[model samples]
Target chain A: MNIMTPTPPSKGRVDVDNFALSYDTLEGPVEAVSNASIHVNPGEFVSIVGPSGCGKSTLLNAVAGFLKPTRGGVTVDGEPIDGPGADRGMVFQQYSLFPWKTVKGNVEFGLKMKHLDKSSRDRAARTLLGLAGLTAFENKYPDSLSGGMKQRVGIVRALATGPKVLLLDEPFGALDAQTRVIMQQILTNMWQRLKISVLFVTHDIDEAIFLSDRVYCMTARPGSIKAEITIPLERPRHQSMMMSSEFLGLRRGLMSLIREESIKAMGGELNDLALDGLSIDLHGQSLADVL
Target chain B: MKVETFALRREQQTATGPEIGAETSHVRTVQSPAGAPPQLAAYLRRWLALNRRGLRAVLIGAISLALFLLAWHLLTENRVVFFIRFTNVPSPSAVYESLTRAMQDSTFFTHVVLSCRRILFGFSLAALIAVPLGLVMGRFRVAHEILFPVMEVLRPIPAIAWVPMAIMLWPTNEQSIIYITFLGSFFPILVNTLHGMSLVDPVLVRAAQCLGAREVSIFREVYFPASLPHIFTGLTVGMGVAWVSLIAAEMISGQFGIGYFTWEAYSLVQYADIALGMICIGVLGLGSSALIRGLGRLVMPWNRT
Candidate 1:
């Protein structure tokens, strides 16, 4: 696969050191993420997997310059991120394409803001749309497209701006199983061709293991890095490779790491009363024993 | 490989065929005859089939209106003296006769044209002022705080109540009437636009920011377009109120316009002409609202589905 436009060499390198964020509410400041440190080298694919409310999205948002860290710093290529710019592209889980614009129009938006010429904008948008297999939907509005198609357009729109890094917040979380698999494949193909660093946030263990070169597991809130696991899987991975023992072993290790944090996240919400029904029956036999 | 997968999906979708809605199935059953060569007839048949439900709704509305007219006719023709007396009320036939006469009279058209002009001036001015003000207030906290209090204090006072003050303020009756109409429509448009602005999804703003949109572009591209549907809602409601205020103001102060015509007919004891004037107002109000809706559809084509 030939690269349409060559990316700048060794540009996308993200570093977050001892990051902490707390938001104010009626009661007081609530801590979301604390003492979280992570980094992605240029042209690397990194995944952050944790239980809900583990601030995986917060970490991603900070990298995209959407939020200001209360403590510590975030930088890309040795320069601190002051605010959001075209250098870091973000794809939201909600398929946040502008409803008023067509797919191609959405893709052209960032380029337009960058003051690209009309012909160049059109060429860039069309090229990205073709790469995403959305040439048929170039003129279709975001509302008319299905979830999978809309997310594909979102990805294409983000990539059209030629960002050094792509930040995705569970971009495939809303898709059905079949569409999600296909989307993963499409995304990997695009990532390979673009040669850009990716910071993907997801709770799915299999998704994390399959897509990332390295996976970082975070503890429950206030979230911090729990473990960093390297994926030794070879490049150009196939769907059939998921059945291999090596893949299964990676999946098992990631799942247990996540399951422990998930249980802890639920600990505050689930009291003894909630677990009593699961423990024993009226006949004095434990429910687990009967099952 | 991706292309092949997409092609396979497309083939599957085509094999399954397009899904038809439950309402459309009945229309499909009443299809045009096979091998029919009359293109005009075939086209008409297809149109009728597509619009069967819409046609049924129109038929139902007409029947309901006929029933109301019959009840009114019966009550007046028999001179029924119940809790509310119909003895002095004009019969449906009398009103219809007067309507026909008024239709032929050039002066009645003059009244309608003058009234429509007032509404056009007042409503357009209201929309032009309110939309921008509302957008600014909705997006900026300082603007909202400064303007919102003033608006809240004045909003409770009806446009009809402003007629006297308008008469004293404006030099001419035409200006005063137009002012009243403006007062009637201004608040609804402003308030609804503000509401729309508040409802804009925060995630969208973040997405735009991530795409390198500055503050000005975000306001122009995201906030403005997102608030449009609510602005249209405001316009429709404001239009109705504008007509009400325009009529009231004209009846109070004007020498021309449909409202003045109706008041004049009542003074002269031409009860039938009074009814005719009211019918004219009804039809014109309905027509103008339909115009606004049509304009809305044109502007927001993506919202049609």
Candidate 2:
């Protein structure tokens, strides 16, 4: 179900050192995450899973330098994060591909920002597009592509900058189930090839387990890490492997952690899918993509 | 809950339905075309079916226009309309003859070229100023705060009302007319461009930033293009306004141009020349608007696909 390949030399190591984030809403100061520490080793794939309002995305945003930490700090390769930079590439849950640009243009945007010459930028963009099976659609706009295709382009665009770390915030949440699976496979393939550090934020336990070497489960509002579960499943994951005993055990472990936190956060607001707790009966139920 | 079950079942059906429908459609499409002419006929049938609504709309529009023209002809030529009497209005045939005669006249060409030059100059000048101003105002709160109030005050005033002010403000009558045209188009273009820039998705901005674009780069790559569709909307609207105001200005202030020609014809009581002038303005307006639309299509390649 999984195949481990020889790892490439690790280039990016992300360290979230007791990071905390808060927002000043109309109501007052609201803490989103507090004292959340996580380490992604070089070439490691780590997923942060949590309930609604659990600030998993907040952590990812902090790492991406989109939000300032309230307490501790995030660093990439020993450099303290300040603002957004090309060193950390992020793919949002929303397909953020520039509508005006062709697929190639969007992909080459990062390269252009780095002041890469025209020929090299084109070569790099063409290479990534080919990697995503979108070389033929280079001239097409983002609007013309399917949701999955757009997200794939999003990933390639992030990768084109040759960033040391790739940050994903529920990248497949918008896609259909079949397409989601396909994208997961494509992402896994790309991750294996590039061997860049990945900090994935997702709500789906299965997706977290499927994609990451370790999964960090966060508590609800005033969010912080509740549990860190190591996914012992081998690399190069296949869709069929999701049904395996190891995968199910890991999913069940993560599910109970999330259910407990969600029940506390919502207080009987948990629907049947959430109420099902750790059962596999909720498979294909189309639960909320967020939270 | 029952709702969850229902939703899951519906999703399953929709998911499976497309696969089955696609397979059958593929087979049917392959089997349907038999011979060359038959295949061509089938292709045309498909094309017609796809564009049936558009074709119907065109047909309806043509019929309405034809009916209106017929009514106009009957009313003016025979003076047979129930409530309205046609006294000064020329018959359609007389107007047509005048139109043909005007088309052959060198004076008509001079009038047309002069008016076009004035419009092109003013419109281009307005666009040159408005587009960047709008983008800046839309992008920066400080710029917006400073400009928004002034623009709002000016936006409601009619372009014709600017006639006296424009005349006093500019040295020559021609410059004043151009200024009036500029005033007519400027607000619409600026307002629409601002709206478009504001409507640009914040996610696109964030995505661009994450990809390491600085402020200028983000504006060039994201804000400018994102606002283009709205900008074109403004351009077309502004063009129409520019023409209307251009005519008014030309009639009031000029000795040549179509607007002056038409006003001169009306004063002389030559209804045929008046009709000819109206027709020329209408044709030119249509052509210019169509040109703007063509430019819009050229710039926004994403919209075409």
Best by TM-score: 1
Q: Write the per-residue lDDT of candidate 2 for residues A1-291, one digit (tens) a residue.
A: 011233344668999988888879999988888778999999999999999888888888888888989899788889999899888999998888888889999998988898888888888888788989998999999889999999999998988887888999999998888999889999999998988899999888888999899999999888989999998888667888999998998888889899889887786656666566753454565566322
State every prediction's TM-score relative to the real structure: 0.89, 0.88
Q: What is the lDDT of candidate 1?
A: 0.91
lDDT at residue B204 of model 2 (Cα atoms): 88
Compared with the true structure, model 2 gives a TM-score of: 0.88
lDDT of 1 by residue, B1-305 (tens): 34445666665555455552233634652222233233566667878999999999999999999999999999999999989999988999999899889889999889999999999999999999999999999999999999999999999999999988998999998999999999999999999999999999999998899889999999998999999999999999999999999999889888889999999999999999888889889999999999999999999988886
Q: Which residue ranges in model 2 land beyond 4 Å of their true spot? A: A1-8, A268-291, B1-38
Interface RMSD (Å), every candidate: 0.6, 0.7
Query: How much is the lDDT of residue B169 in candidate 1?
Result: 96
Which one wins on DockQ? 1
Q: Write the per-residue lDDT of candidate 1 for residues A150-268, one digit (tens) a residue.
A: 99999998988888899999999999999999999999999998889999999988888889999999999999999999999999988998999999999988888887788789987
